[model samples]
Target: MTEKTAETKVTEAQRAALGLAQLSEDERRRGLLSIADAIDEHHEEILEANERDVTAGEELLAAGEYSQALVDRLKLSASKLDSISEMVRSVAHQDDPLEKTLAARRLDEGLDLYKVAVPIGVVGTVFESRPDALVQIAALCLKSGNAVILKGGSEASHSNRVLYELIREATAELPDGWAQLVEAREDVDALLEMDDSIDLLMPRGSSEFVRYIQNNTSIPVLGHTEGICHVYVDEAADLEMASDVAYDAKVQYPAVCNAVETLLVHEDVAEEFLPEIAARYEQAGVELRGDDATREIVEEAEAATEDDWSTEYGDLVLSIKVVDSLEAALDHITTYGSKHTESIVTDDDERASRFMRSLDSASVFHNASTRFSDGYRFGLGAEVGISTGKIHARGPVGLEGLTTYKYHLEGDGHVVASYAGDDVKPYLHEELEAEWTPGDRSDE
Candidate 1:
């Protein structure tokens, strides 16, 4: 008789995260090495699985289930594969933020207070078709001493599972169940409800998906809701610089998160700048949605709508609006932006300075493309994701984003009662910037 008993399942999200967060620096380094080892050992398997996903992805796109860009990004090549492995190695080589002592103070003669970095514990990532995100996220979480649980898109499910297998095989040398992935039903709810096992959820797909995760789960969610990035051409903007930056921001990689979705040009330079940028978009086959003012200015542009302003057109679609001044652009972004990346092109020193200081996005740029608002360009070895939420990490979540702090007080049993005494007083303090710059701030 072929009879079977009930099968049980377990989510390592919480357990892995808690374990990774509590790991010593040396253990964390070992985790990073394990990911690198996995990628190196399973290259052929990962490549084969990617090929199958590509075939299925093509059929899905043919049926209008996936986009061309998404499919293409999901295809993994040798160089990209090697890069992911190198990234894990690099992450292991970087400084361990969780080991840093952020602050220290004296409560009494023998007692001291300490603020040190600690992991946020288990991090759950829900991303789209990019298979490399699995490796990158795993590398970052391990090196930062946080465990990660990934839930990729349906189109890449097979590929994701295969990749997870590879990672697990590589890390088999580590403590049992130290590294893990979520392979539950795509029911979305089951994935979201693994909150019982997950400490945090990072959705790196569309605004809708991220919101879904945030709405359903009590777990902390990381990643931007949208990347309606903008590039403002100032009145005194250098035409060449503005054109190049705008083109690169829009056309360089139109399908990714960092690409520009909106173009704001000061009326003073609208005629000159608009024609140049519009022509580039035209050549790239990018659809242009222009405001009435922009429509009056550009003949071939289509009429814009309220929805266009708030949309994250992860394609060759861009929204164009004319602003009276730099202030207008900043205000518009503040109103409609997901607070991702915003750039101002100008030769005016005052306007540039003010724009940089005024905008409230994760990355504010001057005389550059919004594309530069990335992990690698910003010199971070790798990034888990670009986050918009204000609570934990606000911008690109690099090594520093993975860490929260813990106070380690030494000095012969320090007691708060001493500071409460008549003559004793508590220490003064200041809030630290969430910015995770890699180097020391120069005194200059």
Candidate 2:
């Protein structure tokens, strides 16, 4: 693949998106299959490039410039590559997202209006650490009929280049510039300037980074910032189930954004639950910090500061707090939570319902781990990223998230002047169970 400037890429992507949007769903599915097939055929090449990236990442990690979590996300093995391929295939199999009528209504005697789904044109995504995100984002955009401009972390440069090139080559039969990979750090600045060309910007990073993007860009921003998630153990909870859920939330995979960062325990259960869960955390090499009430129960825990409540460790480190009631837990989470994901462990259905309904986070769970707040796990095929914001898409963003709707109005010899005249014909505005199709007439 030849390198292109950000301006050129964005312009090409705009044109390509128009062409891609006109293709049949089957044609788009075929393009996704090509990408999956390419991954299967060139798995070794992708891994070799990933190995080089991992080596460089290791050197940076040893120098203390990179976190272990960052390096872990940088490396990819044979199984990871297989998963990537399967992800693309799964995207292909998703029910078609475009051109489906969302709502239809009769406007007049021979006129009807329909709300139909359409692509968001060009999406520019800036993510860190995970090169696999490049594939997931690209496959989702292709399947949803949008052109994607992917800018992954500098740490995964080599791996991203190989994967982007493979995808671009694989989908050669489709529009040429459907997927554009921008490798330079400065390219992000260029991307921000082209709000007219790029319909949306999804940036996955720190709050500061996402804020910078939002502050600088006029384009609609879908920000995926820190995941300071919480797991609250209510007084009515089962100790065993609480232990299992909290353990998996924090220990199952602590490197991702959805992993639990803070643990809230009811004062009623503090004495009994603190020692039990702390032992499991300690055995897993997790560093635990707790409030006074918790430290009184678990002697091994370090003192947790106010800052610890809002931190996203993204590691095997957890901050614990003891709350007097479910309401206290809700107040603490509201003040410190990132609005990403939170779970409440309680056997009482009323308490669980209250917890699930009251929190403003993107995902809420009852007696389940925060780790399950994922797109693929939520049956979204795959996710571009999880949006904490309330606009457009929230939680795990899949093909549906990538789409926005258009109003398709079908009228036969109809004009607004007719409705303005003194002998105006009144519109019989009514909802209809109809799909939008060309040359289809309404029941006259």
Candidate 3:
């Protein structure tokens, strides 16, 4: 038998997606649970494969070809495996994303229309590093009843191959081609051309890479680009609380997209808050670069260049700026932030509310850490990626994000001619408090 090409694989996934979409919610849930169990049972094998990738990644890191952040994301441990498995189960337990009635209205006496949720058919996702993303994306796609075609970064080829094979074998009872893994770099360009076979293309990577995907693909692209997130300490903020929030936002996990990259301090609190946070960051080995005002307050800080504001370091480096007021802070973020996630710490409810409402980012937090802007933390299970676009899905693209709705209309042998003719009847368009049952009459 001949080996299947990338086009053949995606085409098979497209056909399988139709069957997967018709499955019962419980059936899809079980398939996800199966994947979770398989992960737990074969975690040792996963770690072994991951080790090979990490070893090679470390050699590349020495050569300066790969960043420490990429290697960190590529390597997986037993604890991380546990978290990955648990995330899968969490997705399995989420509310059914399919067949939910979004809106119900009576068009006429017997004609009723319903907006029902359904799968988006075949999804082709290209993500960078983070082998765990494979599990999250696959589980979310299956639970939402959509087939997926995945392409991971070359850095995690070994890890991705193992995880993909494991998930494919675990879900053997389901449609044969529900999940397809394309390992070659060339597969991505091929995927970009299959607009007719794939319904949605989600790419998670650097801004330039995402732009490249968007430009080349005729298929609709859901892009997750660089995250230049921020944290602001308001003049009205409690200095102690602000210190803790700022510290956690940047230091907790600096390699992920939600991690804070810039720190904005109100002038009123800069003298006091900067020293405290700088000390903590220093203790944690964070390299701080600041503007002239920030450098004045923290003399030990290095001068921040203009480009630092828009860069996502994805490391233990932070950029600091001193803003004279909340308005100044907002202006700075609007100008340089990636519209990903931003947090403000303040005691004034009105100010907090204003800040939250004013920012157009995917998530704006008040009195909390910017790192809290995650799908798993938000209780939507794990995210395929954090989307910065204002499109069909924004923020964390989870199970619900993987779905789109279809309009279901039910009528009783009703003819359009009856509503048209000498006396044309008007549409009621009245809202209803009812759920849709398949084949059920609207008037009954």
Candidate 4:
């Protein structure tokens, strides 16, 4: 098909999504709850379709065409489906992000100004093998009153197709094409070019893939290209607690982006903490590559090079470094970190405060595991994706991130001449406690 043909589909979808944008908050909330219930009721169908995708993924794994991580993400169990349902329900119950008055000011008597949140029109999301992302993105879009066009990896095609169908059916009573699925790879290329209809593009995958989307598309992109996350153990950290937190951060879910890939330890604590953590990592089958000082403390660790510092292993392999001071650790992270998530384990409150304030990552933590950097964990129901970019949205993008605001001015036949002429009515720009309620029109 021609480019115009593809743009027409997106245009239709955007039109449908705009209809949803005009809906009352209660109407949208009930519609999302209904979609969540429908998903739960159709869990078996989703699981059956997921099994087909898993089988295909296994074949690809055996042929060396797919990584173990992709296969794991492609497979879906009953519990995962239930969790997806729960997240959908949670999003449905979240405060509607649309039409809430952010600020109000009285321009003059019988004239008022208000800023209200609204949807970002149509969002085009291209994600990799986690089929559950299809449901998560659709639910968040519906709750935020944005239309979305989803393109999931071919690895989970069967699962994504089933999930998309279920979501479309569940929200059928609303707009006709609020949630559209584009399965073909060529369609993604077409989508990247449709900047007019698609307001935002969120691509979730490798750094290269995200960069490719950002470079190829004129549509504003909102997502992290990589997640070279790190965890630092300060000199004042309790060695036992440091080891526990570090172990959990790497092993809780190594396949995810938030999993810590680099571990930095203060030189004062390195000798004692290194061996303890190394032994624990051994038990978890984690491979360690470290700097000269770290290797001196832990003989089992392999020699780490400059490249190791910036690598996102996304596996059990971890790179460890020994920093002489907190300043050195911060400098190391600033040079190599992906600005996704970083954490410092320390008992020194002042040192922790400095570390937290100085770092520029999306999420900074003190005395916590980096694994805690998640949307569900942050009580955002679930995320469309994590963004390391500093504009529009940052960190876990949930309902609030999916929306933008519009300024609404109400006036009684007010004209600029009244405020500008010699017979000028002195203008009042007073802040008002009054907000924009539904059906409050100045014309009435």
Provide the lowest-lDDT 10-residue window in model 1.
2-11
By lDDT rank, best first, the candidates go: 2, 3, 4, 1
Q: Which stretches of candidate 1 lie over 4 Å from their true place?
A: 1-27, 37-42, 186-188, 191-197, 413-444
- Lowest summed lDDT across 10 adjacent residues in model 3 is found at 435-444
List, residue by residue over 1-444, the lDDT tens digit for candidate 4: 553455666987889987999888787888778877887898889889999999989998899998877787787888888898899889888877888889988888878889999999999999998998999999999989998898899889999989888888877789888888887889989999888789999999988899899889888999756789999999999888999899999998888899999999999999889988999999999999999999998999999999999988888999999999999999999999989999999999999999999999999999899998888899998999999999899999999999999998887798988888678788789887766974354422
TM-score of 1: 0.87
Q: Using Cα atoms with residue i matched to residue i, what is each candidate's TM-score against the true structure?
A: 0.87, 0.98, 0.98, 0.96
Provide the lDDT at 424 for model 1: 76
Lowest lDDT block of 10, candidate 4 = 435-444
Cα lDDT of model 1 by residue, 1-444, tens digit: 642111112244445566656667787687678778778877888888999999998998999988887887788888888888888888888887785767655444544456777777767777888888887887787777776666677778777888787777766655445456555445456656666666677888778878777888887778656788999999998999999999999899887778999999999888877887788889999899999889887889999999999998878889999999777898999999988999999998898899989988888889998988777667677888899778788778888887787666546654567667788776544333323223323121
Which candidate gets the maximum lDDT versus the true structure?
Answer: 2
The reply for model 4, stretches above 4 Å from the true place, is 1-5, 438-444
lDDT of each: 0.78, 0.94, 0.92, 0.89
- Which prediction has more favorable lDDT, 2 or 3? 2
lDDT string, candidate 2, 1-444, tens digits: 867799999999999999999999999999999999999999889999999999999999999999888888888998988999999999999999999989999988779999999999999999999999999999999999999999998899999999999998988889889899898999999999998899999999999999999999999999989999999999999999999999999999899999999999999988899998999999999999999989999889999998999999989999999999999999999999999999999999999999999999999999999999988899889999999999989998999999999998898999999888789888889899998998668673
